[model samples]
Target: MGVAYSVGEVDHLYTFFVQWSPNIYRKRNNKSSSEKDMATKKTVSNSKASKKWEIITVKDSKRRLSLCSSVDSEAEEYQEEDDALPVLSDHSQLLDDHHLLKLAAHMPPRTRGYRWHLVYSTAIHGSSLKTLYRNMAGLDSPVLLVIKDVQKKVFGAFSSDPFKVSKYCYGTGETFLFSFNPDFQQYRWSGENSYFVSGNLESLQIGGGGDGFALWLDADLYHGASFSCPTFKNAPLSTHEDFIIQDVEVWTVQS
Candidate 1:
């Protein structure tokens, strides 16, 4: 009922089937290897893209920070330029141009841009305390008192209120004392005393405490004294504690 085959024919058919199976397996293996290679390439490309973005982000951040610092530096430079030298009404006998520049740099911010007007000068008005007081009358603005001693040591006081005869000490903490013994020195309120300034019929005082005065001027405006005082914590303003006044000037800052 079945057709008979020779052994050679059966062996030949088996050999053919085996060879064909191997070829199909090789093709499948090659396709899988190709897919794996493509996947690895895609991963590598994605990694490269991520690193590029990261580097760009870091660079952008640094650029922004540098820009901000540059802006701040420019703003600071502009502010310094705005604070120029102040204008004086006339030449000063006690203060030269260099001294005036240094003193102007230390004045209150509110008074920096205004003009300095000479109200009283011993060289012009003569040496008299009464005359000085009369010239300061009705002036509600700040005043600068510059004194040059016989030793040529220069010192001064910045008074918030005009000098006048007062029973009690009167002046704000804005009052300060300064000295220029070849170099400029400023003494601000020490917060140790409220005796910033006081005036009497006989004398005028800038600061007081510890049984002494920072600056004292006699009625004649010809003699003066300076000592370490609690109000400004300043050393003796003059070369000596008591010195003869060679020159005196009072300047008022005006609008």
Candidate 2:
């Protein structure tokens, strides 16, 4: 017969090319498993937006460390109220004679050369002139009097009767009336107790039995005397003798 019809047309065409090569390799392995599930959902949404930006950068670094510890505790309470406060002058009263002749006309001229020692006859009494005018007026704390000289003679000796020819001299004259003590040791001679005249005779001058005489007159030497203490209450005055005052006279007294 023609050679069995060409061997049955080569066995049908080799079984239709072996069933179309296994259906095109199962549709290319289902399109590579749907592109590996869309690249694992874009790497799990970029790891949840990088864990929500590291939880808002750890809450803005704990609110900048609690606002820098509340600005370092209000700058240490304004440096402890600028270290406290009070400075000069403030006690009450008792440093007068035009403020001791404006503090012996602003002292500062004693290159250290003067000494006429003879201290203590109660050391200038009146309870030490109220404790040297409450310590030169510093009321008893800050002081500084360096004037080196200022005087007026005859500090003591008043017995015209106990058989002593003529004695009644109380500090003679050249302007002498001081006050400074709150412990600068002592420097009192408020003319003995009181009298800065014209300012209306300040008082205390009897001069005999009731005993009184603390005078300080000098609206420019209007006349002055009385280094008294005929018993001015507590009495004190007699830094013996070394007259001449002024050089250093710092202030503050009355502790």
Candidate 3:
């Protein structure tokens, strides 16, 4: 079935679409043939096909969810019993799966809903730490923060609490900054979200705050500093731009 639009709407759409378009329009039976060539360059990309699905069944006397991905009308599991997980070329896809699995591990066994799902992703929210924190306020769930450096390396951490302001702002060592590739490095929480890299040691990290979580990279302001508490303050900086705030997602139990 084709979409049905009113004659007035069709005309309005046509005129509005090509107003600033630079492409040459050709007439074929009174219709421009260039509509099919739209969206040539990708603004956003995802490795997993949109046609994803999940199902739960009784197996081994335990409930387990079977995730299915579509390829040429053929369905395949994300994690196969006999085969290892496929390495996705797209960072977004790889990150998405990692985030989901990280959250799911803390949730119910094969039941779903104990961990966080993507409520706020910087990829869609844009690159403002303040704005990112502002959008994530008041969600009652543990937060996970991830960042992709200009080095093209991906890393982040998991917080045990929701992003918010407390009467007291201090570190509880409940956050861990971890790497997703090359080296799986995870900094043990120092029992406080506040700390200093100390003595010319460069740092890259993230954490929760009075407002929300901070996603930053190598910042000069905190370069070789000393502090009394654990904190995630340095902004993300890369060789070119600051740091890429790759993603921020909340993990919550489904009530």
Candidate 4:
């Protein structure tokens, strides 16, 4: 969800252009007939909303790219309000502007405009897995779990659903692991198994295959492990398979 801007607050709305491929999320977020029509018309019509954004689609024939341009108006006077940067929660210890930009590029379109709310952080909350679970109790939106290891490597997972203690793993394919070893790399589902994420009192696990997990955090929230898993086909997330957690944070991806 975007920040609601009143009409008189801004004169011109700049367009937000996103380059995407149709087949990238083929199995997820299937488009409905109405959505197809909206794409064909190159506009997203929300008559009920007080502020309407017109989405213009530009196709790149050579690359078959789908470019979305969302603009409120084409007025000459440009305003910075419409293009406000994502508002990070207060005193984030893990994320910086560069990291946020890279992660946002791969995030789902619906979550583009909203601010990220810091729901849990070891820096704020105590370093306990139960405390992390308690913080995410009833959240229904997507969550980004970031971890910094003792070696100073930053990595984590993006949960399509909020983390919960469940007997059976529960999350959509949108759940994926990511690592930033100076450079950012994300691992999406490989369709090998449905074990996207599972949480228990003892541990939290993301991805599973070959008797190993893509990412695992123990109950203390101090010990962590990463391995190559069939679910995401991802390599170890840390410098080593086993790592000591320096800090952890969970941010709700508002939409």
Backbone clashes under 3 angstroms, per model: 0, 42, 22, 1
Alpha-carbon shift of residue 106 in model 1 (angstroms) = 1.3
lDDT of each: 0.89, 0.33, 0.42, 0.83
Per-residue C-alpha lDDT of model 3 across residues 63-124, encoded as one tens digit per residue: 22222223422433433311332232223423655544553443223334232355445466
Off by over 4 Å in 4: 1-85
* Clash tally for model 1: 0
In lDDT terms, how accurate is model 3?
A: 0.42
Q: Kindly give the stretch of ten consecutive residues in candidate 4 with the minimal lDDT sum.
A: 10-19
Which 10 residues in a row give candidate 1 its minimum summed lDDT? 78-87
- Local error of candidate 3 at residue 158 (angstroms): 1.0
Candidate 3 Cα outliers beyond 4 Å, as residue runs: 1-115, 165-173, 190-255
Clash-forming residue pairs, model 1: none
lDDT of 1 at 98: 64
TM-score of 4: 0.67
lDDT of 3 at 1: 88
Better of 2 and 3 by lDDT: 3
TM-score, one value per model? 0.68, 0.19, 0.39, 0.67
Candidate 1's residue-wise lDDT over 90-202, tens digit each?
Answer: 77898886677778888788788898989899999999999999999999899999999989989999998899999999989888999999899999999998998889879
